[model samples]
Target chain A: MQPVYEVHKLSKYYGRIRALDHLDLALAPGKLVGLLGPNGSGKTTLIKIGAGLLTPDQGSVLIGGMAPGPATKAIVSYLPDRMALPTEMTTKDVVSMYSDFFADFDRVKAQEMLRDLHLSDSQRIGSMSKGTQEKVQLCLVMSRAAKLYLLDEPLGGVDPAAREYILSTILRNYSEDSAVLFSTHLISDIEKVLDEVAILRQGKLLLHDSVDHLRQEKGMSVDEFFKEVFRC
Target chain B: MNWNITAGRPVYVQLIEQLELAIVTGEYPPGSRIPAVRELAAEAGVNPNTMQRALQDLESRGLLQSQRTSGRIVSANQDTLHTLRVQRAEVYVADFLRQMHKLGYTQEETLELLQKATFPTVSNTKEES
Candidate 1:
């Protein structure tokens, strides 16, 4: 089977500040991979390249055998690190907007998730708490039946309880034919939900292996290994 | 079923052990259908792939049987279940012995300690009588 996402010797630069340097990675379908690194470790850069927000200076990235383009965009659902939704729009309005824009969007599922979270259609995005906004965005992103999901810091800034809810929502909504790549600094909180882990540092890929193999080989959890590998 | 997953060990290994415990203790019950992989993965807050690996491991061990239409069911064989129970208990016993050895106790000393720990209630009852 073809990999859901692939990158080969990909390189990117920000006016001489290298963000991604000769990085190669691949994600197979039916896996939840944790893209882990510290701040300014090129995690976001790699995700952005995969999402088509930025073009690599060298090499190539393919999503489901096609480069990031309109075709690939249709199958990639990206949730940026910060809020990207229109604040003036109500929760109901956002659902309608997504449904109108993406043919694969499931409005009913989005509404059901919103209702379960006790969020009303009348609630405006600007008025909701930061955590609530994140939840709403997650609902919108996950409501799409996309083949690949690139979530940047989906658990960041949320309280522990909300984090648990978000993690379970992602797990419950995930499709077996699709793959999810979510980047986070909080490794311990999200390690359980990941089948594989890719650790990056200083614009380079450090390690990418199955979580079980890592634990069995090192006799330590992913979080512990991350701390040891990226320790100052 | 509260899954106490710690960071010191592999999550899938823990998953396998807890799932085996659930089946052997009758929490899932013999011959009962288990929840779908996605549902159990959500409940455990782990990825479906990781959960799938654990389930596959159990299926290979003959503790679980997968049906095409009905999903996975715990082993219905009483003999298999009984054997699993014994195997699980033996693991605990081996772990205890290893810990005692770590604490500098020889096999004889460990057996003595086990006897002492097991007979206090009997001796107290005899005294009261």
Candidate 2:
């Protein structure tokens, strides 16, 4: 089977800074992979490239066996690090927009999730708390039956309870034939949910392996290993 | 059921242990159809692939049986389940004995304590304290 996401000799640079240096990564279907790194470690850069928001300077990035393009974008649901929804739009309006734009969007599922999260459909995005807005964004992205989910910092800036909800929602909503790639520095919180982990440092891919294998081989949790590897 | 998945241990191993316990305890009763891998993974908050590995391990051990159309089901063999239960209990007993030994208790003392714990009525006066 083709990998859900694949990057081959991918390189990207920002002026004098190297954002990603010949990075090679692949995410297979039916796996939840943790893309782990500290700040400015090119995690966001790699996500952007996979999401087709930024084109790589060299090499190739593929989503579901195809290069990043409109076709791939249709099958990839990306939740960026920031709030990208229109603040003035009501929650229901946003759902409608997604339904209109993405053929794969399931409005019923989105509305059900919103209800479960206690989000009023008529509430304006601008009026909701940052965490709530993030929830809405997540609902929108996950409601789609996409083949690949690129979640960048989905757990950032949220309370622990909300983080748990988001993680479960991602797990429950994503299709089994698809894959989810989530990047975060909160290793301890997310490690239990991860099947594989890809560790990045200074624009370089440091390690990528099954989480269970890492623990068995190192005799330490992912968080501990991460601290040891990136210790100052 | 709430599974306590501790860090520093391989999650797939923990997952297998937990699932086995559930099976032996009848949380997933004998001959009952188990939930699909993805559903269980989501409920346990682990990855689908990890859950699949754990389930496959159980299938290999004959604790679970999978059919092409109906998915996975717990083993209906009463003999296998009884043996599994005894084996699991032995593990606990061994661990308890090790702990007692660490506390400087002799094997005889440990057996006496176990006897008292098992037959509380006989040691009710001591337990009152």
Candidate 3:
């Protein structure tokens, strides 16, 4: 099957620093892929380029047969590491805003999720805790039935309980036709959900394959293999 | 369910292997109810759907059985676990030997590392602890 998102020879630079260096990535439909990397490994830079939030200095990124334009944006649901919602907006307001912007946004699913979590719609974003705000952000992103979901650091910097909630939300909301690419340094936590993984180091692609293939061939955990491969 | 996956294998398979190991190790014994998918998922810091896939796979393999209201339970027999463990151990040994060869460890040197590793003698007094 053709890849939903095909990134070829993609390279990005931050002045003199190369954030993404000739990175090639492909995503199949319904795949939940983990993007693993150390700090400054260009995971975010790749996601930003995929989200159209940043432009590549060289190379190309295609989402759903087009560049990262409105056409691709319509089908891609992107969650940045930080919450981008307005602090002044209420939870309901955020839901309403998403409903208005993305026609594919499932209002009922959003409401049902809120009900499941017992979160009050009346709660204002500014008053909620960071973890709670993350829940709200997750609800809005997952509620959309996008073709591709780019979750940058979905499990990063969150409490253990909150991490569980976020990962579950992604799994439950994503459909079989949709592809989810999540990037984080917290490998052990999110490693279970990832059907495939792409390990990045120093802005280079070190490995990419089904987790089973790696384990069966090497007879080691991804974490141990990572430590050994990237050992100084 | 709250397993922090330490395996190098695919997540779903690693998940199944871990659960199988738990059952074999009597962590979740035969006929005993295991954590609900959501509960285990929440505990292990993983996605419920991912955990669900592992549970379903194990259930089909007869390593686990899932009931409607009671959640999942360990399968009665553990022959599957024993078979898998033996296969994995062989792979681990092969890789270990390969690495030892790559690291230029002679047969005697490798045996020494193994003995020092397996049976810490008086010479193993590294006082670090």
State which candidate has the highest DockQ: 1
TM-score of chain A of each: 0.97, 0.97, 0.95
TM-score of chain A of 1: 0.97
Give the Cα-based TM-score of candidate 2 against the true structure: 0.93
Per-model TM against the reference: 0.88, 0.93, 0.69
* lDDT for each residue of candidate 1 in A1-232, tens digit (9 for 90 to 100): 7999999999999998889889999999988999998899899999898899999999989999998899998899999999989999999899999999898899989998888777879999999998889889988999999999999999998888778888988898778789999999899988889989999888899999988888889988899888898788
Q: Over 4 Å off in model 3, which ranges?
A: B1-129
Q: Which tens-of-lDDT digit does each residue in B12-57 have in candidate 1?
A: 8999999988988899998899998888988999888888989999
Listed in order, the DockQ scores are 0.65, 0.61, 0.18
> Which parts of model 1 have CA positions greater than 4 angstroms off?
B93-129
- Residue pairs clashing, model 2: none
Instruction: Please report the candidate that would top TM-score against the real structure.
Output: 2
The RMSD of every model to the true structure, in order and in angstroms, is: 4.5, 3.2, 9.2
The whole-model lDDT of each prediction reads: 0.90, 0.89, 0.80
Q: How many backbone clashes does every candidate have? A: 0, 0, 7
Q: Over the stretch B1-129, how does candidate 2's per-residue lDDT look in tens digits?
A: 777787767788899989988988899998899988767877888877778889999999899999888899998488888988998899998998889899999999988877787554647858786
Residue B27 in candidate 2 has what lDDT?
Answer: 95
Q: What TM-score does candidate 3 reach?
A: 0.69
Candidate 3, lDDT over the whole model: 0.80
